[model samples]
Target: MVDMDLLLALASHARYRPDQLAVAFEDERLTYRQLERRVSQIVAAFRRLDLAPGDRIGIATYRGVDPVALYLGSQAAGLQPVMLSWTLGPALPEMAEALGVEHLFVGAEAAGLHNLATSGAQVWDVGGHTADIGGFLAQSEAEDERWIVRRDPDQVSSVEFSAGSTGRPKAILRTVRSDVWNAWQRILAYRACEGDRWLCITPMNLSVLSGMVRAVLVLGGSLVLLERFDAARTVAAIRDGVTILPLQTPHWSQILEQPDLGDIAEPRLRTAVAIGQRIPVGLARRITAAFPRADFVVSYGTSESGMITALSATDPAFGTPSCVGRPLPTLEVEVVDEGGRPVPPGVRGDICVRGPSVVAGYDPAVGPIVSSMYDDWFNTGDVGQWDQRGYLYVIDRRSDVFESEGQLVFPGEIQEEVSRLPNVREVAVAGVQLEEECQATVFVVSDRDNPDIASIASIEAAVARVSQVSFRIRSVDRLPRTLGGKLDRVALKRGQW
Candidate 1:
């Protein structure tokens, strides 16, 4: 394999497979030829604004063709593109300015649009690829030296902002080589091929989405996107010629609960990947049965490390929430103690990993998650243990674990046991403070369309077997999730329970 950037790879694919579909979002489609042209147009627009190479541009648009177009356009013209959180509402403009993003592309309907008028950066309304940006693209001529530019391997290729489920977010800057390596990593992990079509259910701004898009496009494969994750829409997409499907833990049970899911036989699904959070065996088994032709896998990693380990449901040892399978072939993973010494098998300790595509470090100024960004092995801040068979199990995030009766309590342990309860659709557990006491709260949603939820006494009885902590079980219609469709633990801890 040769070292290649996403932009260079795009040009190669466009040159050979001009008629192949490159991206699909809703009813909008872009073949390789059309995607290439739109990227060129975006490059021209950037040049017309006199933006120089290495200039950082911001993309504050909703999910659609434009964000990918802008990303390719900037990188092809030798610039760095950062995906800003459009959900920030009024706080977006100030956040954009703090990052030194001079030229911004603001979607007309983006939630941050209300505050765009007062921003220091130049803003453009290109919602659904309409407005002045469309006019600029319509006037650009195709095929010029502007189609490609010299890019340093070490240059910043993309900047990904973490979801900050812990507290505050951090900016993870990846270089051209690093980004390319990560794309290749996902491609290898998912066994992507030229004919594969990935259905991206996650938000476009997510770090995982960036790699998945590149992996598909780099292989001349097609990408189908959803504005957001919906169980009905996702099930419909899978039945309609989607070869690969990836979703978070919370999204799986919902898809299985879809009344229409069992009516359709979606044999076209070749791979089903579960990420974001752990998948209980029961949920994983249901998912495995749902996609008879697909391989169900659990992908475990962090923004700092690109896909450290993936456990297929087929693995004989895949029955626990923490069993994340073995480390990927290209990385080094170790369970270290408080003194930084490697622990023996079955010993729980800090998880440290370093390898290709692993981020070099975070921007030191983004002090929110600096504890994990030190030199050498990146401390994942996750408590983990390695079984005698070389299988790794992630115990819990060090920060998420709480003390109860002088014993460390893992929220995942409680959630996993409660997830096994009958008629319990979705459950999220977190340690919260209520009247000077730390309480383990289990926010649950019932599967049946009835006001009655799972028995609280039964849930309490189930969790009592797992830990001694007192849990306050609350039945809610649904759990609050982030734009990425992940359980927003940060919000749940902030009295949102």
Candidate 2:
């Protein structure tokens, strides 16, 4: 059996590699020795709080050194950190209720912040309690290591909430086995290694935090986190040698188009992975052109399924910018019809997967997200098909599929087609309800010099070529986006601008 104590493993890595840099902030670098000491003190601090092993603590803090300390310290204490978004401060009580969290570790800014309060939880301002983790480390003693609990691989390591595409976010309880294996899958597939630097520009609350924190810590890599995403800072980070940077499509696309990256000097920078949303074909091509030496990869997955698909420069179909790469190691992807039988090559069907990275189920699990598992396989709710050469291409979310004038329309297909139009930076397609049913409507970001009408006409011509055209077009200054920077299709359909 595998010894699944991440804290123990971290401590061991520190003991064996004391001189090696374990983490780095802007100007300060921490060696393994420093990290171990900090972890010890943080564990001591946890004892001061009177929290015990298996106690659920909610971590609602900003991204930076402190958040990382809280994460590691909680693990050291065998406390599961239920990570909550700072934006959802209003919903903390409900969220805490959902996760059964009793103790809250919040930031200084959030001391009095609460729209609703949990019945039996105490909120501690982590910022006020521990300003300098390294400083705290100086006082730590071997006796300070007050806890070393048995770790079951299956025991919940974290409780993450999924951005409910349909409605309210769903709480997901994840195990140490799934979390560690998922981190390894990313490392193996992406070739992440020691000394490689990663920047946390994505939301501190969700997928990026989940995948990145573990990957950076366990692999002895450095994580440069941003308080929020600033395009210039991103470009600067890439130019100044932040390798292995991952971003949502929109953010990375904008970064590539920035002229600033052309002048930055960094030899160690190598790969850039774009996740969260579909990368525009033109944007991907431009990004590759901009960073000639960088390995450009497009990743596809959800909060429920950690990185099920990855498209890398080495894939044979990598030339097709719309294809989001083949399934990475530790994942099995299949396209199935309504009857649950596998679809033929190039035929559209629901994309399903069986894998170690996939969440076993969700909390208060309902419907197919929980029950549709055929043993290990999961219905992904995404419509896709594999090519004869086995390249998986996601078409669209099955729930987003709509019929227009008796012809089935996949919103993704339209978005993909329009994404290739010249000067059209990005696009989101949603079906607007009419008298009886829904009709496709497109939203786009394009060069201000050119009217969106021209881009729409181009899309109309392409749709006509496929003979599946039946939609209207509307242009806005900017498309509404989710906190993660994905196009907010649901909000668009609801007439929320």
Best by lDDT: 1
Backbone clashes in each candidate structure, one number apiece? 0, 1
Report how far residue 23 has shifted in candidate 2, in Å: 3.8
TM-scores, each model vs. reference: 0.93, 0.90
Count of clashing pairs, candidate 2: 1
* Ten contiguous residues minimizing lDDT sum, candidate 1: 129-138
Model 2 stretches astray by more than 4 angstroms: 2-5, 16-21, 24-30, 108-112, 128-146, 164-166, 202-204, 365-372, 434-437, 448-455
> What global local distance difference test value does model 2 have?
0.70
The lDDT per prediction is 0.76, 0.70
lDDT of 2 by residue, 292-337 (tens): 7888888888776678878887667876735877788688888999
